[model samples]
Target: MSRLATSVTAALVVAIVTSWTTVVGDARADTARTQPCTRYTAILAPGTWETHIDADPAVPVGMLRPLGDGLQWQFGRDITVLYAPYAASAFDQGLTYAESLSTLEATLHHMVATLCGSTRVVLAGYSQGADGIGDLATEIGNGAGPISADRVVGVGLLADPHRDPDTTLSLGNPQPGDGIAGARSQDFGALTERVRTLCADGDLYCSLNATASPFLSALGKVLSGDPAPIAYLIPAYTDPGTLIEQAVTVGAGWAATAANLPTILEGLDTLPRLLTSGDIAAAHQIASGLNAALSPMVQAAASVDLTLVASVIRAAAAVDPSGWTSAASVIADALAYVDIQRIAFTAGHIQETLWRTMESLTRNDHLQAAAELAVLTPSVFDLADATLGPLLTAVRGDLALAVDTLLDIGGPESIDELVQLARQGAALASFYGSNAHIDYAEDVQTLLGFLRTQVAS
Candidate 1:
């Protein structure tokens, strides 16, 4: 279906579901239980990837332990850890995210149904688990979930991939658009004051700047086979001529120093990769088939400017080697030139790269692998609850074949390698990692304090 038709159909389905939820909620007037709970607080944590309930919360030492352990220290028997489990593997993220969300909804309903009226629930999660909790919070805040917004004493989501831009209560800069999977169709205005989205700088999953856009757009295109939204972004980006014009307009007499050449070249090399590295697969796959589709236009628009930019930088570096600040200035000028274009081409590059990659994948007859990933596109409608459920279940079989295909798509040697790379780069570097994917020790303390105030006993 065309993007427009698909979008319209999805919207109609959401409208129907919204009406159904409202009617069901009205018929069940008694949403909360009458019995008073002996305990004041209950904590629920979802496992990042699991098909069943987790035995324990997956947190690093001295991280979120303070909340649970501290609460136990205050009231030993009052604290209960409810580990929310679901299929959290990368390949099944779409399925597990939905299934775990439903499981959490059912669990919350049961808790409110049987627990004491005064009980306050504290929700916390990390990574995929964070996405599930954040999504649930969005649902409750919007008055569509099983639980009431008031019952939520505190919510702590570490590295939540679905984090919305201005609404986050946590520290860190705001990102463009929304999370990697994009924002919920509705707002969480109900929990606006209570929810916190903590993200460190350079976490691509939350931010849409230089590092995130290319990868996200690429992933989006591969999964959806649509790129026009991102493709049209080419003109919006700074052209090489614009940067050169700006530099010459400054007309500051800055000559290069021998000491600065290495740094300048390094920065130039790193800058291009930084802005464009997200197209790893695209770089490899573009030649496979996209030549007939996108190459001509891309070449016509980019060839002269690219060559001009490269020539200017090389010439600038070769001019003079005596002025100390001149070399540094040249480097700075080059960096500034690259930054704007980097931001601009991110979306377009992602589209081009993913389109090429898809073409190659199909030609290679990696049909099942391609099909498995095709269903993971971000949508306002619930794909898991829809007809896609059976496919999700069936794909779990033939584990070896599925894993191989997914690994290639992700550009990782193995799952372990990807995990290691993520851990190393998530908070500091610009590789494929999210701000919401790190170990949030400080946030745990904040969560504990927030819960303490809400459940004053």
Candidate 2:
């Protein structure tokens, strides 16, 4: 599915970037306080993504919300979460992936150098931010950073929505892989378990795409939205003390590179109509002719400009004593979902892997990390010895394949005709024996509902 801001304009992007939340008290200042760890939760938003991370500056993100109510409890402790935006690398306005990411790296590097490095951190993100966090986590987990995974104590992630899923009609109707199919709560667990002492879990955003099948994509969690880096909220100045020009440059890049987002959405809208037609074989003809799972979703959830979300928050920040009234309800339920799934994915497997990763955590820096890594960590690493390293090495291929499947199948046209496509998935699974995309059908339905809320809201 095209999980991005379909209509986000460049101008809006320049208006929303913003800050950090650091708690100065000791860890024991208040067992009830989520801020005692000297925290920095920075959000990076997309020009058209959801408003995650710090919904409102004064309010703590996730579990740290000021009101006792907005707090998310896990093992009875509040987790300090940060969201960093990832600008699209292909913005038409003179931006590229290398440059956008470089901007993020510099900011994160600063955060680590100035504050985050001293204590444990719970780096969190969605969409592009998710990708960045994973990349960042790997660097930190593999080498040196302010806080190591072992020291981090926890990592919470939402739908990373980076892969593709099958879009055959057979996988329609929430049978499986509702949103971002291949991305299981368990998958993210493996990625983050090494960081926190506790079990890790993530929110999945899988949705039903056209192609009309009842089975779900094995890889569907692709629509997770974006959050921007905190830096963009307050507008910055160039060397001459003027506004930075590339702020909107990234948006232009997206218009050029991922411009297909609107087309994808429009194409999928036809699936329901196609499935409703009376001819099953004709529908099958349509289904059999296409390979939806091969396409997958695209774009950086970091597509939305954080500046826009910040503008919304700035307007509403002082409206009431509580930030977002509904945040309490949303966070509580979501946390419950994440915590339960974390246990299921780990099933005690994570604890063992954690021990293995640590042995090499401080060692294999030169091989696994960027050239500058050894200088960042305490210097003693070796991933080869870590049991979970093998799984991580394998993750890239699995996820890459998953991405292709989602983009190929989900689109406005594909969505209009899912039932027959879902039936096709059943046929494929029965004959081909359940490929990666087959499992996401059911979950896609769930994702549709969730995604609609995040943006249409």
Candidate 3:
């Protein structure tokens, strides 16, 4: 054959062979994924930001890695271990909790559908992964799941946000409270005896003082894909009596801000000087105090409905014009040009920036602290100049007048006391920063022991 013809034929042959090999490889992978185990299967879901949507199922990662490895070692060739792949992220990072839940449910359903009916199933997860696993267990137990509840031989969860102490077996020391996102509305039904949860003490994701702060509880519920709390919260803010209470509450917040404004501003003014003078410790102290004083205001700004507050103030003015007229005018004017949603967005960003700055200071990361403060300082000043300057000025100018107006509306006698309650609610939402939540490896042996006992039977 001619050289040119031979070269072209050889190139075509190579291309064809490569394509055939690729096709065979993909077919084999698919067959392997679908192959069912004879005895048992364990499926593990990792926590938020731990695994990607297209993660390799063979390589386990995150908090549940130890448990996955232990199960493989114990069962050897008798069982199959699968790590679910999903977009494990909270709303702020990428996907919402609800989206993650949906992805996890689909993954479990596919596995259960493909597995042999007689093959026992084990499930495990940690943190947000635990949240999804617990929910699935509840669904399956209630007879609406992808497989029969009896197929589930064991389930283990660490730091499950929807943990119900009454229904699920808890392994560790008694937590002070239920999960931060609150307990599941429905029990685990048939799987109640099979499912187990462990929460480290002081872990806010698994335990939060919900009773002490119903507002925070409601916020948690909202974040967990439940809008039921919002329905109740919205009405509470609009009811006449509740409106009066909230008005007083907000007025009290303004009053506190008015009192602290000087100190906060002075601190801001002196912070640059202190940093320039190389007095980092003094700057750190000032930043700490600023965080303490500003945290509540930022939380209030993010949480409070100014539009609703304005409505309450207007209603009060209508009821007692003589008492509320001037206060109403000032507040109305201040709110007229304000965007409630933007205020919330700005406040949330500021709160996060302030927190990062404080953390840097706490860690004694001077360069990082300076960098964070540099970002924070201008942001704060711009917020004051554009958004808060008018409102704060009004509050500072007629503090007593605003207090009298709220009192005249016939709510709490002491606005400060009511504001303290609001502050407590904000505090409940803050993380406890416990290492226990992520220390699942410490308890993996206990988890493995439980799984071994359950599966062996």
What C-alpha lDDT do the candidate models reach, one value each? Answer: 0.42, 0.30, 0.62
Choose 1 or 3, whichever is better by TM-score.
3
Return the lDDT, model 3, position 358.
64
Model 2 lDDT at residue 283? 28
Worst 10 residues of 2 by lDDT: 238-247
Per-residue CA lDDT of model 1 for 363-440, tens digit only, reads: 774664345234322210121122124323433333234234435644464433322212222323333323344545
RMSD of each: 21.9, 28.2, 16.6
lDDT tens digits by residue: candidate 3, 143-233: 9888899899999988888877877888867676777678888998999899888887667667766655433343354555532212222
Q: What digit string (tens of lDDT, one per residue) describes model 2 on residues 1-457?
A: 0113312422223222223222321221233244455432322222112333223322333221211122223212323333332343323223322234444444455444444444544454334444455456656665554445454433322333432233212212323333432322223323333321110122222223323322222112111222132222322221100111111122222222122323422322332244344232332333222212112111111333333322322322222122221121121121211222222222223223323333344575424323332222211112111212432343334432322333355544432332232243333334333233223222323332332232222
lDDT ranking from best candidate downward: 3, 1, 2
What lDDT does candidate 2 reach at residue 137?
A: 60
Give the Å shift of residue 438 in candidate 1. Answer: 2.5
